[model samples]
Target: MQKHTISAIICLAGALVAAAIAGASFLAMRKPDLIVRGPGVTDVKMLSDWFPGLKGTPGDTEVYILKGADDGASMLVLGGTHPNEPAGHIAAIMLIENAQPKSGTLYVIPRANASGFTANDPQEGAPQSFTIQTPNGPRVFRYGSRATNPIHQWPDPNVYIHASSGQTLSGSETRNLNRGYPGRPDGTLTERVCYGIVQLIKKENVTITVDLHEASPEYPVINAIVAHPKAMQLASDMVLGLEMQDIKISLEPSPVNLRGLTHRELGDFTDTLPVLMETANASQGRLRGRTDEALVLTGKDKWYVRAEKLGRLYVPYDEKGHPLEERVGRHVTAISELMNSWNLEHPEKPLEFEGLPGYEDFLTKGIGVFLLPLPAKN
Candidate 1:
């Protein structure tokens, strides 16, 4: 064979191999993570059951219900609103696999934006997934993007406008589930998902709604709870309760001007009191050195430590950075305290549950210790 012909063949072969590897990765991302139902899960339903518009769509997600034996006020817990924030989703997963309601129902949507879980953000250098070592073995969970997968909802406009509030944001935020609140049934895929959630709240008469989240360590809102006006009193009491446990969380009132956020829209549209909690996550921070599974799990970033020393961070940081256990612990502890405060204030409408690990327990035992074992195959 001629020299040039030989070189061309080798180049083509390498390109084909690279394409094959890329295809396999794309396929793997499409596979959903396995989430086992724990003892507390009384029933499992689809979000479409409330709003049929999402039926058979990529936007549909699972809703795990743990109903108490006695009648009382109910609460809805949303995790994975932004899938990149692992603590929120992990906390919701832990609750699904552990909490057993005693007085009122608890509805948990661990993957609030199902479409977002199927892909990673471009150029983010993020891990596709992470694993937790459980007693039975290892359980893998997806580390996904912050917005709806472009594959599902594509081509952003120059500006995105809120359906109800007429507020505008950058086009990229149109796919953000957080900014699609009080959504429209006849809107975009993200908007439809948000509409389904709003429908669920109104239909179920949820007394309270808690949206879990994480923020970059440098973000001022880190380690804080943002509550709607109607929920301010409840959040204040919960903050005090958490402080008593030495958890050290701050309280912020949801900005009325923030049009599409859950704490604002949910409270404005429905009778449900809305609150959102945030934790420090170094893996998602701009100062993070290398984004990988370890960064997501351990959160020990030297860059973040340096940033902290420079007084550029909102949360305290040291060599023992904010580990996944600590972040998840903060979220779980806040939810537990919120429930306690709610019950204390509204004894007749108590929201009670059991089996959730405390903050100290998460720190000592690690997150894997609380994860329930997978069921046996038939």
Candidate 2:
């Protein structure tokens, strides 16, 4: 064979190999992560049950219900609104696997944006999945994109307009589930998912709704709870309760002008008092050093430590760094305190639950202790 022809053939072979690897990764991401139900899960339903428009679509997600025998108020906890924030999802999973309501109903949605888990955000060197060392062995979970998968919703316009309030944001925000609230029934896939959540809150008569999330360590809202105006009193009391436990957290009222957000829209549309909590996550921060599974699990980024010294970060940072346990601990603790505050204020419609691990428990035992082991294959 001619020398140039032989060289071209070799290049083609390399290209084919690269394509195959990429294709395999894409297919693997499409597989959903396993979430074993626990003793507390009394019933399992789909988001479509509340809003049938999402039926037979990827927008639908599981809703785990833990209803107490006694009648009382109901609360909904949302996780995985942004799949990149693992603590939110992990905390929700922990609740599903452990919490048993005593006098009220607890609804947990581990993955609010189901489509987001199918892919990673572009240009971010985030791992597709990360594994935790459990007592039985290891359990893997996806570290997915911040927005809904482009495959489900595409063609971002020049300006993404909020449906109810004429607020405009960057076109990319259209794919953001957090920015698509009080959604239209016939809107895009993300908006449809949002609509379904609203439907669930309204149908279930949920008194309190909490959305779990994480922000970059440098973000001003880190270690804070953003609550709707109606939920301020409840949130204020919860913050104090958390502070008493040595878990410092701030309180921020949901911006009235910020349209389409859960705290703003959910409160305005439904009777549910909406609150959102944020934890500091260095792995998602721009100043992070390495972007890998270790960074996700043990958020010890040297660059963030330097940034903290420069007074560029909101939360205190040191060599110890903020581990996954700490972040998830904050979320779980906040949820428990919020429930306590609500029950105290409205004893007539009290909410109570047990089996949720406390902050000290997480710090000592680690998050893996709360996560249930996977089921054996048939």
Candidate 3:
């Protein structure tokens, strides 16, 4: 063969190899898993139902609505705002798949940012999915990214100025769903998702909005409730109630200067009271030794334990670690307590639900037991 012919053949082979790798990567990110709804989910709709502009976009996500026969107040729970935090998302899923409202309405969005779940933070070395064994079988859930996938909305500015409060953060934060509250209809994809959520709260006349999240064990905000000023009283009561049950949770006032967070912006922009809860997860922490499925589920990290020993960690960490079940349990129990506290304050508009496992139950039984089985193939 001619020298030029040989060179062209080699180049063609290299291009084919590159294309194959790219195709595989795309499939890994785009594959969707089945999440069977529980008895409580009476109706399911997309976030686009509230904001038509989001229809057909990756920003659109599912909203599971559970309504009771009696007239009462309504609440909205958002999980998976930051995809790396599995506990928050799983806890919300637990509610969606198990809890049944008897006196009011419950709106649970387990994957509030569906697009985020389609990808993982590139440098994190995190697992693509984690499994929980149910009685029926093992169910796998995605371990996603901390922000909206940039592929959906790119060209972030050098600095991101929040639309409502003009608070500036790093450029990448523009894609953070929590920071895009009271979102603008014409804003970026992240802002649009936030806008859709705000629209839902307003249109439904939601009384309370709770956003579930997890922070690194080294982060000071872990194992605490950050409530907007309007929600402080209710949150305080709930914290006290949790204390009675031996669940230690701290209460932090949403900072006025921190303008774009859910606790801050959602409370400031809407009539509905807003609160956010955080649990500690070593997998997402800088002090974590290795990032993988075991770290995601077991939460045990030698580095975290050493940090705890040095008193450098915010929450207590040991060899046993702060397993996923414990983190998820804290979230589920706190949410129930918040509802109970809300009921005590507003008897006429009480929100009641059943079939949800509390902290002790989760600690004793584990999270996999409550997860529903995946649907059988045709």
Per-residue lDDT, model 3, residue 92, is: 88
Model 3: ten consecutive residues of lowest lDDT: 26-35
Model 2 stretches with alpha carbons more than 4 Å out: 1-13
Of candidate 2, the 10-residue stretch with the lowest lDDT total is 281-290
Error of 3 at 78 (Å): 0.2
Clashing pairs in 2: none
Any runs in candidate 3 off by more than 4 Å, and if so which?
A: 1-15
The candidates, ranked best first by TM-score, are 2, 1, 3
Per residue, candidate 3 scores C-alpha lDDT tens digits across 1-378 of: 999999999999999999999778766876655677999889999999999989999989999999988889999999999988998899889999899989899999888888898888878889888988777888988998899888888988999998877889999999898888888999999999999999999999999999999999889898999999899999999999999999889999998888778898878778889999999988888878889899999998899889998999888889999999999999999999999999999998889999999899999999988988777789
CA-only RMSD, every prediction: 1.5, 1.4, 1.5
* lDDT, residue 246, candidate 2: 93
lDDT of 3: 0.90
Ranking by lDDT: 1, 2, 3
TM-score, predicted candidate 2 vs. hidden true structure: 0.97
Candidate 1: list runs displaced more than 4 Å.
Answer: 1-13
Listed per model in order, the count of residue pairs whose N, CA or C atoms clash below 3 Å is 0, 0, 0
TM-score: model 3 vs. ground truth? 0.96
Query: lDDT by residue for model 1 over 150-261, one digit each (tens)?
Result: 9899898789999888899999999999999999999999999999999999999999999999999989998999999999999999999999998898999999888899
